[model samples]
Target: MRTVGVEEELLLVDAESGRPLSVAARTLQYAAEAAEPAEDAGDASIAASGEFAPDEVPGGSIEHELQQQQIETDTVPHTDMAALGEGVRAWRDQAITAARRAGARVIASGTSPLPVEAAIVGKPRYLQMVEHFGLTTTEQLTGACHVHVSVESDDEGVGVIDRIRGWLPVLLALSANSPFWQGEDTKYASFRSQAIMRWPTAGPTERFDTAESYHSLVSAMIASGVIFDKGMIYFDARLSHHYPTVEIRVADVCADAADTVLIAALCRGLVDTAAAEWRAGEEPLALSVAMLRVMSWQAGRFGIEGNLIDPQTLAARPAREIVADLVDHIRPALRENGDEELVERQIAQILERGNGAMRQRTMLEKTGQLSDVVADLATATAGLEG
Candidate 1:
């Protein structure tokens, strides 16, 4: 089975006021101290003793984002959803604990509930981004969930990406977790999607039938001075430059671990199904980028509450029906991976209880307080406290 990995960005917020805090540097420092090696051994003694090496936390797995208000955690690639869930939960809990020690709380929110004076981290690359993009880069306080599924080759990966582009909006709708932004309900399910769209290279990409074409387009974008680098190729789904995988960058940062697992499972399934089709020499869908953008917007606007543009017909259909179609589309892959039953149950539960956006709205309606919303979100981020 192709392994899947997840990267989630979480906001560090004030425990009492629900305001985002720029304490990621402090929290990471605390984590490092907890994992660092004891200072006692000489270089020769350390070389002699293999066990005395620095017990430091893996720097690459958990790190700061563009802003100090947000931290990102990535899981090891796993073939099983349960293992992925455990990894995600463990990392999240660790982040929360680290933030608490730093006098803040980590909330798995897509956007901050309170207004924030965004503080950019003092990193050279991020500083360049801020200088180039200006306000667009500085205003980024959004968090998102990205799932990476291994692909055998770039050819196969681009093939899978081409076929799977239409189905991404459903994933967006299912993971819609950002309803409130800057203390006001944006009235859109995943307002973070809108916020991130300020990037010139963000959102869906035109079909690149081959790996060569994908590389060509990326090169052209950089050469044209439209983007800083290949990393700015922020398509909804793209061939990962750093990994042998296709990374889907649509969903909001889920408030619950289970939802994150479900998204990962479904994404892996979609990639598998698309690869199978590629093996059978099936032609990829030729959906227009303009239409794909519209569909994406519809999903972010209504989530599962209204209609979504159906992947098959590109016609507006009830969100439930669209979600059902997605399930059927990837059914074979799920069963093959022994995830059919698990994904079905998760999908039913999500449909019944609602996505994070609906739950947040419902909580605010009952409590009539934004702080209550943040409190409930923090509880949910811990587990199933909601």
Candidate 2:
């Protein structure tokens, strides 16, 4: 089985007011301290307050983001879905505890519901990005859930990327969580997807038939002075710089742990299916980049609440139908990995309860307040509220 991992970027909000808080540095510091053995009484108190015991899962890390109002949590790659779910929950709990120590609450919302003056982190790379990108960097406080699935070789990875392009919008629709942005209902399910497209390099890419073509394109983009480095090659799906895996970067950071895991499982299935197809000498769908962008826009605009572009037919269809098509396309791989039952169950739950966007809007309808939405997100993020 190919190991899969998840990285979620989460918002830090004031526990009472639900406003975004610039305390990521402090929160990360507390997390680091909690991971180390206590050297003194104060250190012991800090470690004790973390509330979570370290797990045997390796490669898990907590890191600061470009903006001080968010932190990112990474799960170690795992071949088992149950173990992967545990790692996600454990890391989320650890982040919550550390954020509490820093006078903030961790939230799983993709964007803050209330107005926020996002503070840029003081790291040299971040500062340089701010200087180069200006408002694009400052205004980008969006969070996303990225899933990495291991592949045997870069050629296979690129082939998988080429074949998986058409179905990515379905993943985005299922994971759409950012409904409101800067105190207003944006009338879109995933405003974060819209916001991130501001980056020049962020969006769909044309098919790269080989590993050589993929690397050459990335190097050309960087050399053109549009982006700073390979890290900025923000294609919806790309080969990972640090791992022998293909990273799918289209989904929002889901508020529910189950939904996050479901996305990861689906991503792994997609990669595996694509790789198998490539090995069988199948040609990828010749979808144009423009059409893929349109499909992605439709998914972001309505999420599962409206029609989505079908990958097979290239026509508008109900979101449920498209999602079903996605499942059927990857069913074989999912069964091989023992994730068929889990994926089906979770997908049904999401469709019925609605994605995070629907849940957030429901909270607003109940309380008529965005702060309450944030509060509910925090509760859901900590796995306290269903």
Candidate 3:
């Protein structure tokens, strides 16, 4: 309940070709105006030693993610939704213009529909990753918008993650953007989710009851050398030891920055409300990991069209109704955050026709080519245009 912020992993793509652009160098060069040595010291990035993500953009510029293809943009902390939107919009618009000047475009989808050739800009860290994780990892170059909400305590972070797991599917369904893969429709809402899961440390996490337990597991995993660093524990939800927030990593990057803000608001609101309920002596409702996995699979495979089992009532509900129910549940948080209208609009858009997957499919059906998918992606990225 303290405040909320977001880290968006954006794909740098060729403006005319829609292919992934290896412009982290050029993009970082553009950010040189703001990148001081002290400001660039982000929690050790997987991208490169020089790669700057959350910190380089003080005034607003694209930062780096773990991969060379990624530009991690961040926001100023805000307790209310309006301030969150303003910060996020300003940052995204700056990134888009900077990317445009470098012959690139910014798209925030969870995965690129077409396979962006593994033409990494060739950094040592990227090379290290390739040697460690291999070609499949490079081939699955995807992006997601990570939302972090500050908590009053470590216990609150754990509890927030516990209750928030049930809603991960709903959030993913609402933000699913990777419909096509390797120039063909993968017939799923978020091929990005699956693609990202290819990594050994990626995807949904096992339930944990305490911060001690979570920290112990991560420490053991990192020590075992399976995960290179703490940040590599890419779970649906994790307590960011780096920050005091329960970070929701389930959502794909929305094509639009507005969509990104909505996702962040909804996520922050849910955590705040759930924490409040927990404080009031309400038991944290949790479903089996099996149930959560299946629901997440349904969301990834069929999106809002698929049926999902409700975690609270144990009854199957249409994904749409469930999403509406979630929006309603988070209304107080959204209203408090000054994003009531956007939260409603984003939910309506998800339930109305479908997510990015549906729109990408329609575009492909109309033109019968990956080129059309790129066009649709461009349309989806419109919110970030300067």
Q: Which candidate is the best by TM-score?
A: 2
Where does the lowest 10-residue lDDT sum fall in candidate 2? 41-50
Residue-wise C-alpha lDDT for candidate 3, range 277-330, written one tens digit per residue: 767757666678777778788888877777766767867888878887787887
What Cα-based lDDT does every candidate model obtain?
0.85, 0.90, 0.72
Query: What TM-score would candidate 1 get against the native?
Result: 0.93
- 247 in model 2: Cα distance from truth in Å? 0.4
Clashing residue pairs for model 2: none
TM-score: model 2 vs. ground truth: 0.94
lDDT of 2 at 107: 89
Superposing all C-alpha atoms, what RMSD in Å does each candidate have to the true structure? 5.0, 4.2, 4.1
Better of 2 and 3 by lDDT: 2
Error (Å) of candidate 1 at residue 128 is 1.4
Ranking by lDDT: 2, 1, 3
Residues 1-386 of candidate 2 have per-residue lDDT tens digits of: 99998999999999889999999989988887777554432212223232334342224777778899998888778899998888888888889989999999998988999999959999899999998999999999998999999999999999999999999999999999998989999999999999999998888889999999999999999999988899898899999887889999999999999899999999999999999999999999989999999999999999999999987779999999999999999999999999999999999999898999999999999999999999999989999963
